[model samples]
Target: MSSTRVGRGGRAAMVAAALVVAAGCSDGTPTGSGTSVPTSAPTAGGSVPGGAGAVKLTVDSTVATGIEVPWGLAFLPDSTALVAERDSGKIKRVSGGQVSEVGTVDGVESSSEGGLLGLAVDPGYPGKPYIYAYYSGGDDNRIARITYRDGKLSEQQVILEGIPAAAIHNGGRLRFGPDGFLYAGTGDGSDRPTSQDDNSLGGKILRITTDGKAAPGNPDGRVWISKGHRNVQGLAFDGDQLYAAEFGQNTWDELNAITPGTNYGWPAAEGISQLDGMTDPIAQWRTADASPSGIAFAKGHVFMASLRGERLWAIPVAGGKRTGEPQAFFTNQYGRLRTVEAAPDGSLWLTTSNTDGRGDSRDGDDRILHVTLGS
Candidate 1:
């Protein structure tokens, strides 16, 4: 194995009013940063936060269906997206509400939670015509680069490998940062000790170039930007600040404001421990209320997709800090939400994880949905 290092909204006015009242900030002002709320306070479909209150989601259409555990969703220069299947190792193209097979990633070994997980189109696409993937191989998890052209995939060039792999906690989510470098999230692989181990790549946020070497200016010339995470599957950027959603043990799930060279308390602190030298999540939820996987920033809010909680959470952010309480939407409406991505057309594309052996699969159990702001 090789090691590298680096480093929404809206709503009807009346409904928004109700939420502002419920939040006790009817004046439409934001609350404090790192605010923690009870999972029981804002029930599903409650008042949206002030920042997200003006925008409401309306499912416009189903873009694709019959996908076998679509885990990674990345958009091309043409606005069409490439979707990766976790279990099948296949990459599908979704455009104009039609789905077509692009290509399958080789050597993908699916287990409890590991498989082909994250996808990212080269920031300079068309010119680069390359796609990056994070997948679980037979012995370890790897990040590979593949060329796409004429609907075919060239042999994968493994850029990074040797991340620990386990049945449950192989963290896989990839995105090209605003800095033009690639970022990856890894889990502890159920080995709690690794979360705090600086030498281990597991349970760390890695920053690297497309070639998989540590990005320039990374702390200690290592690929890790931050460490001490359980299982991180959700990563989104609001301008320059990066936010991550991670799965917790039994007590809490976290939405942290990721900073380089920082240590996020994992095995030691589940939620708001206020421990010195450790960064706490800006917001957190009960484990049962939010096993958040994918998150996107749109409409002045961070939209988080919940798997175990079967809900979508909207957390209002202003100037890179949480301004209002996190609000839950469409609770149990879309079972096991996996990914939420903001589209070029100012809409959002969401995927369901019903067919992932966890949720109850409907006829169109696993599908990509097109959602837009409601009037």
Candidate 2:
């Protein structure tokens, strides 16, 4: 790592070069994230918080027949679910207890860690009729658009190209902010210093328009939004607050509040810090416990998917600070947890990642787990 890192754009070429040497491998089934219903609704078994003490887990393997190395997931406006399988490059739709292959994406660069990674519905483009995707293509991270209507893909449009890619730090999570802008987390691709450089898109959380260009009113007139990140895979917004789960180099993974143009200190700092000009992390855990991936806000808590820790974390966020200790569930049951979302009905939807050439998975290992916390 350089003492003073080069700008983000300048070092992206290094990422492209690194991925070429390693190729071949990999791999969410988001089961929920719905609208507001009153808490008094009736359940078939009565409302239970679904915690370890209150309830037990029931994993479903019937739907696993169609998902091959599942990666990311999204929900349609009509309430149908779309899931991406990284190795298969196929997108599957689930509705009324049936999972169908809607379509397949081409040109996915399936290296050790590069492939179709993130899928997010356009919050503002809901009326425009397209879903967005983030994946590695030919060893570079890219964002594209697919017309996903009536549970099928009709048109495919490559929106933006030339994001840095490597076996690590591709920053593959995508989500829409409360402001209706697309936010993406990119990894430093082993060059940790690039995270602090603004000119490149790697190692940063990018705020972009629907067209994959940087949103207007940005502090710098480029795709770089917030610099100094290693491999941020989890993103969520609470009311108006922005939060992210970031993977650290060799130390602690972090939970942070996303602020525009503020550096979070990548090579110089791993977790929280008192150093000037370096943003501090709100919460942190050892890398062995949490190589945290997707995160979402639900039922007054922040839900996270852990890849290394093999658990789902329920963190409470309030007033831009962590309220208390997080509750851990599904520990080592499914292998590696990757994504989580709080559905409109209050159930926390979770996705798994053990099949992504990592984790010690059991039979029916990498599967989505739906928990009904209130009963």
Candidate 3:
């Protein structure tokens, strides 16, 4: 699957619409001994020629039997997916026609935004087999590494620690970059100002070695990659370009393409507009089109987890820009959509956030959905 971000005419308009909507409120670790070698800038797949209004994905099916308050999810090397249960602090393996909890992790602070939030598999996994997780800790946020061996939890170890925590805004998302390092997005623990402080780790996109130590090439000596974020819950690299999903505070939520040492305007700025040297969002929406969570790049589209909006938005992204309107689908049909992962089998793995305290829950509540790309 190839992927890239865009910012042209139609894409520009879609982003502008998102901002207009937001005027209201606001909102990787690597693998084993060696990290996954960085690949060339990714080529977004599901290619559909032309500019904005190019293409979109359809929801073929939704899996509901075996999930609860699903937060973050990652597709395994074997094409399966590991999904997190936000309230239960459990990791479940979903594949074939079955879903089962691999096991419940310990030391997870599962209250409100705490609990298991984001996940990534060791890039070398299946061959090396290790899983990385981001969860809310008693007093702060923490990263842990464990192995999903034969559907059970094995080798538990906390690799990173010391992030701010509150009942909400504990950003918990992790991804293994092509560079073979682990990248993490953290929240300000309800303390919005911390995102702008260099010494602080909250509300920033952090980069580190596969082993959880700060990467040698870090922009700052610490793990802080870029600061000034209010609450960022989604992180993805479409090639060398790293894009993030940020929650706006009473203003606009944003989708930004990150550059090394780039200051993404947060608490300081809501939606768009160049503020001094701070970079603005390539696209954004009123905390409504967005409230975005786990993000995935696949089939030439950027799939975002819209929490407050109760929708799975398909933004036809190309060359780093949005092509058309934020296609709002699954609006409350399945409650909140929290995570999306591109699957090896040419499909998608998504998590429902229905049971996440603020959403509407059903008998099945949260579950992982496996489906074909939409037309």
Candidate 4:
């Protein structure tokens, strides 16, 4: 695939040639390496383009299966995707229909909602060959850099640390923005007061260099990009606009347009509130309807994966503002959708969280689904 960075409207052009093959799965056991098991054909779902002139999309097939709580996905230049298992602390690669364990992150303290969470391939890979991962340690949630070589991961280096970690609310989503800076979404570790603290790292979107220091353009001379976010788990960019998917406490889940130095009302406001000095969400959904997690931008729309809601949402955007009602796809078809990523091929890749403790596990408890959007 070309290295050209496609504009928001040109995202569909990045779709690679499709290679249809039989679906395969790994054994039920938890092995760092997964073996392929022949499974039923890929199940297809989606709708024709309609509201807001959204592109037609179809969940055409399953890529890999038997994954245990696949959380983060990062692709290689050649279209190979590296998946991080949230509780296993293992990194697995899915190429074509084959799945194999690359390696596991040492010292990952897996608990409720912790362990290996997010993974991002270095924007400068092959030459740099570094893979960044956000995982939970004994004391806190931290970011580490490791090398991927010969199907193995080694040379782990802690890049950043000290973010609070709780059994829940350990926000863990990492991505490299268009500006080439590493951005992380962190939780307040269930510490509501920390969300409003500027001096603390938790409950903020952190912008930093690959070396772990704060990014140059940060509002302060530290990692804080924005504050007062309760627990943001999804981060993506559409053109120059950054969007975050936040889990609400009791009322509403939000999709907010992020800006540096801005405060997103957390304990002060669960969802939309015309509170003074606080930015409100562009779109908000009832907590039961949207426990939004990983999100991706493609073809002029932001796709969010819902865990508790058990669906995927397509929100159309025009000029940085949502243009129409969000469309729900694959509701209850795939149990607990966890992450949705725009592949190098332009198609959206989604991971299921069926085996993630909270989900209703099936034969192939977890899997990766491929989605293609078109007119």
Candidate 5:
């Protein structure tokens, strides 16, 4: 287990690299970011060969099975992982290759796309020992803080609420950023206008303290870090650069580089646009190919999970920008893929969403798959 440190100066380099990649000029080559793709023996699943300077990857193993709609995953300091089930509201622990329900989140209204969606452990866990979650409550979406001790979850408290919720567009993905603040992805609650409204909490990425208040240095001292999103379901940080996986309507699905106070045109712009004062997505996919969900960054690339597409996409990140075309893995082999999370062991943990009333569920219906990057 090696330690990976992405410093601020490195972030500037990544941004510069991303700008070059965005300009559509730089060749798809890694810039020695201290992380290298592994060259290992072929595993059970076939390997996907990398393009020039791209990281090669393969499916490692299926770690846990029989999970019903596992939506969120967060690794503990001890390398144990917690998985959240959307429809059941159960928080399951994965340790020693076994999955066991530790607790269920109360008052979660599981409707369509809404449910217990995202989970994050306190950065100072054991000392803090709190598990944070984003879920759909009775009337809206909310964040909760729960205590974890002796392998049990207790002392649940709703720390934040008031974001609009919808059966289909309840954005729910929680993560603790490099700056130690909690950030949340939210949807427009099916009202496109809310994405453009600065006062609305929906359709935006929110930066807040662990206690759920506005984070320090937030624009205008508010929870909004950026605005104008349709339904942002995934948020990841590479060094200091933030990237969001957004669900676009009808036309496109987007991967956007997040900048604070920036407006990503939502209803006004679905995919590519030259609209003034609005930020455009660096990468866009047709709706059928990428109904993107949870995303994770590893090995100089961003891995996005797709529900409708039924695959995992690896988008190369060089210098800080996305380069070349994305490669798809496990296309329709594991039903609907919902989440891709980086693990402590440098592998990726992926959850299948077959039981989410959409996919072709098998005997296990849903399961967690482990992926290893290889050369």
Candidate 6:
């Protein structure tokens, strides 16, 4: 596969072909290095000839620093960002470049990749005044609704529990869909059978009401909207179509176009399997190039944060399908990115994960970067 880079004066510069095979590995350690790509500034918004030519990524500023493995990022109505730290179980508030610990989530147990993993502010916001969190509890991974008012978080109520938990691959990423229901991604928790078992919550994309009941009209009235997943970490919607970023076992990492009642072949297959009764990914990369985590849709593209790959990927989409080849940015410049969220101001907030005991920690081991998009 070939990679494209935006060069001087917004020209599409073709880079060398991607190495055919990357060493097999999970998201633990990087197996290969990335080619350093130069960035060019171009005006954002209007569509260019090719989708990839429509936008460019550039870091605008550093939002916060010295933060530990920040995983989930959600914006309040006031544009304040609540960052969930994976190891500390603390929810920090970032406003105008100041980061402050608002409160610690109770009963959170930090393990390998567990802890406070993902957060979603109530879509109703001030009216609902609740923040939803998915974390590793005593014996299982659970979701809790906490009250956030006047700059403090209080009154945590566990709304859902009992998704299998493990030191690694405890999938945790939360977001409210366009329908205003909470959608959660869970891993197989090292149990491969669970990925194909609808009776189990592990390895599935779950849709439920804010109160934790299965959302109405789900397949068989169960909370599961889809099954057969390995470790899903990124969920975003382009209009009504949902896309997911998943960590593969060894060979391929996936970017899936999600649909209700669809089965994504996980234990059976990694990337593109044309087998019957399974859906293939819209895009895939070698695990070494993309241990992708959180993704956000902005500037006519889906921006994905890669951990082992140590880069940000911009995949152009039209009508929820890939319109062109994916492009990489900031390769090896920032180490092990974990999350990316689109801000209200049309910019993006990206988080690093070097301090997660995975990558080499830098001066500010883990930090949030503000990014602006251009043509």
Model 5, range 1-375, lDDT digits (tens) per residue?
121111112222322333333221011111212111221323234434333355666777888999988998999999999999999999999998899889999889887678899999999999999999999875678888999999999988887887777666678999999999999999877666778877778789999888788999999988889998988999998988999999876666889999899999988987778799999987777666667899999877788998876678777765457665666777777878888999999899998888887677898768888888765
- Note the clash tally of each candidate: 13, 17, 40, 2, 4, 2
lDDT of 3 by residue, 1-375 (tens): 121111112222322333343333322100112111111211222323324434544556665565777777887766777788888889887777578778987888686567888888888877777888888766667887887777789877887777776666778889888898889998766665677877677778889875677788887577868888877888877776677888776546778777778888777776786799898887776665457787887766677777776666665566677664445556566667788878887777777776666666777666766656644
Worst lDDT run of 10 residues, candidate 3, spans 28-37
Candidate structures ordered by lDDT, highest first: 6, 1, 5, 4, 3, 2
lDDT of 6 by residue, 1-375 (tens): 121111111101100100111123445753533322222212222232246457766787899998988999999999989999998899999999889999999989987678999999999989999999999874678888999999899988888887866666678999999999999999876666778977778789999888887999899998789999988999998878888999887767889999899999988988888879999988888777788899998766888899988888888886768887777777788899999999999899999999998889999768999888767
Candidate 1 residue spans exceeding 4 A from truth: 1-47, 51-53
Off by over 4 Å in 3: 1-53
Runs in model 6 deviating more than 4 A are: 1-25, 30-53
Better model by TM-score: candidate 3 vs candidate 6: 6
> Number of the top candidate by lDDT?
6
Q: Candidates' lDDT values, in order? A: 0.80, 0.69, 0.69, 0.78, 0.79, 0.81
List the candidate numbers ranked by TM-score, top first.
6, 1, 4, 5, 3, 2
Tens-digit per-residue lDDT, 1-375, candidate 4: 111111122111111100110010001111122111111212244442424574767888889998898998999888999999988899999999789999999879886577899999898998889999999885678888899877789998888887776666778999999888999999877666778977667789999888888899899576878988878899999877899998876556789999889999887987789899999988887666667899999877888898877778888875567876677777778878889999988899999988977778988769999898886
TM-score versus the correct structure, for each prediction: 0.88, 0.83, 0.83, 0.87, 0.86, 0.89
lDDT comparing candidate 5 with the true structure: 0.79
Local error of candidate 3 at residue 100 (angstroms) = 1.7
Regarding lDDT, does 3 or 4 come out ahead? 4
lDDT of 2 at 180: 78
Model 4 lDDT, residue 261, Cα: 91
